[model samples]
Target: MKIIVSADIGNSETKMITRYDGVEGSECFHQPSVIRKLIKSPQIAETNLKKNVINLDENLIAHITSSALNRHSDGLYVIGKKAMQTDLNKVQNMNIKLGNKHKHDIPVIMILAMIARTVVKDEFELNGALESSYQIDCDFVSAIPASEFTFEKAKEFEKRLTKGDHTVVIHLGDKKVMVGINFKKAKITQEGIPAIFAMVYDNEENDDRKVSLLDKFNEVYDEEMEPNDLLKMKIFHVDIGDGTTEYIYTNGVNPVIDACDGERRGVGHATEDAVIMLNEMLQGSFKSSRQSFMEIIKDKTHNLHSEAFNALEAAKGTQANEILEDTFEKIQNKAGNSVDLITVYGGGSIQFREHLEESLRDYAETINSKLLWVPEELAVNLNVRGLDILNRTVFSKNKK
Candidate 1:
């Protein structure tokens, strides 16, 4: 059985979805985009939990479901939730851009390995088939930020990914498994702004609804009818992420290469600001981390200390206003008059939806343009899902 995998490796999170013969399966995985080295302790190294261990050379690594742990000659490494619990200091944030030269870096290799392992597991579950040797062929579709989507950069990414076959050993649940994936082919594209494609594509799937959403959008925005007509429309697409906010203005279906912009401000920046405020409220008495604070913020049932909660709410409000203000100013300066449609997506869209909507109202009124805010749950996965749809509808046809 052949497997097609579409992966989005964002700064803060990694998401993946797998399919076979153009049909999506039940298998999907999401994890924090963090990796850390596990310091070797004589106690851990000497202990033998044979069933829960993955042996790599002379080192033995414990496999925990919530984290990624692997043993190497230098030391054992942990990733995902496990790394956060083990040692926040060891956790490395993989938010920087990696060019052709850094393909062999530990983080890059580990991410690739993780993707391969996910695909293998999905293949087994979906097809009820596994090769005796646990080897499989993969057609990978992935995306990078719009600012780095140049021909040279895209090629560099592709080259690094398709360098050769890769093998990795991982412990999932109680099983020790080794997976080898051969990159039969790979296609990488710019993602941030192009995520608008997913909203358009989803509209096409739900055409039976009372109002054809895209049709109404086109009527209001002066966009062309066909999906491929995206090239002819003027679009200002904004993707607010955890670590960065990227916006691009396109004169046609393709992005206006020079108009792409990315800033370091995002939902994460706001969260950090809030955490600082929370820490200050406690008189620096309680040490707080981003993860811990986020748990409180997200969990409606979690009882927050009154003073800390008030501080957090104030910081979030300030941060949201600032981000929207900055983003609006950039849009006004860049494509305020020329843009026909404004599209917004990504994690920040949901986090600061009220502020964004309120701010966007002014822009829409000023420009008389249509505004498309992708649904909250769909926002984060827009790019990867769009890649999957593009593969099935466009690239596959071209291959024939």
Candidate 2:
């Protein structure tokens, strides 16, 4: 059977989901959105190979791995957390995963790497072993920000991934393998639409994240309306990420162009500022990058916990306020009266909720509209989960 995967190539991380477990369930995978260009040379010690396990395409490569693509790209790179170990200064840090960057080779490579790693894990699970080389056929689905979710952008993205052969050499412990993802079908979905689809269709009854859309609609509207009316009611979705936040207005699953926009002020900006401030404040005594600072602050028992605990909190509050006043509040002021329901989600929503929850509730109450701060556990994966749901239902059916 051809593999079906739904992916979200986020700025801070990449999330991909597949119905590999079964039709009723899914397996979600994550990879850090980090990559670095590397030169495979004698400079890479044998010890480094043992640690990260990458092999060069040499005379011995034929004995250990198989090839499908005629020639690999000259730009050799490492991605995800492993890439983080290299020059921290040079690593592909937080950047908006939209516009030209969305269709660039790095993003495409990241997408393929996520798929390749997932396929490898599944292979190990199914067969209780690893493969030296594997090339799998797949149906790929991923999304960009709703603001850029246009026909031209989506087509360009699809062309970039499916236009040419995509194969990568991956490293394992003391070994290497070539894995390729051949996308039989590629789909680009808007960021928030899929989450709404998940809410309406794919949510589990017993799951705490399972929101009652119809029930919410009924409670809010207090009127019996046909299913067709569901398409007419406007629902605004606010998706917050580490590097970007998307404010989208939707009638059913379709985005309203005039009301939708994306901004660069996200949780990452706050953490980054905190990192810079803390570095200067302590005179480089406790050196921390953004990711390291976040990790340090989260771990209560860490040595730097005392320093990070409250400093980052202040930065977070300030950043959240900036985001609220600058983008979300403006969106609320302009569109509140016209919109029926407002839903807030995405990976970084959890961080901003403490500051935003009550204020949003007040506005929502004042405007006679309902608000949903999607449950934290479900927020991040909702988009990809929805895409996964479509992959099994609408997409497959349309293919038939």
Clashes of each: 4, 0
Task: Provide the lDDT at 131 for model 1.
Answer: 43
lDDT of 1 at 339: 77
Which parts of model 1 have CA positions greater than 4 angstroms off? 21-26, 40-76, 95-110, 123-133, 204-232, 285-292, 303-312, 317-322, 394-400
**Candidate 2 lDDT by residue in tens digits, 1-400:** 4678888777777788876523455567776766666665213335344233222211111111112222343355666666665477777654553444454554565666666666655666567666777877777777777656677888777766666666756665455667866777787766766776676653352255454334444565486543345466687777888777778788887767677777776777777777777777789765544665676777899977886766777788987887666545645664656777777888888888888877877777777776767777677887777788777777756662
Model 1 lDDT per residue over 1-400, tens place: 4667677776666677666665644245666666665554223333333322333212323222211122342233465555555555556665443422223244344455565456445546556543433666667777766645666766666665566656654543334455666666677767674465665566654334454335544665586665555556788877887666778787765666677776666666766677677667667665544545565666667666555556666666876776677667767787656776677788778877776775785677777766767666567777776776666666545562
TM-score of 1: 0.75
TM-score for each model: 0.75, 0.80
lDDT agreement with native, every candidate? 0.60, 0.66
Q: lDDT score of model 1?
A: 0.60
Alpha-carbon deviation at 71 in model 2, angstroms: 14
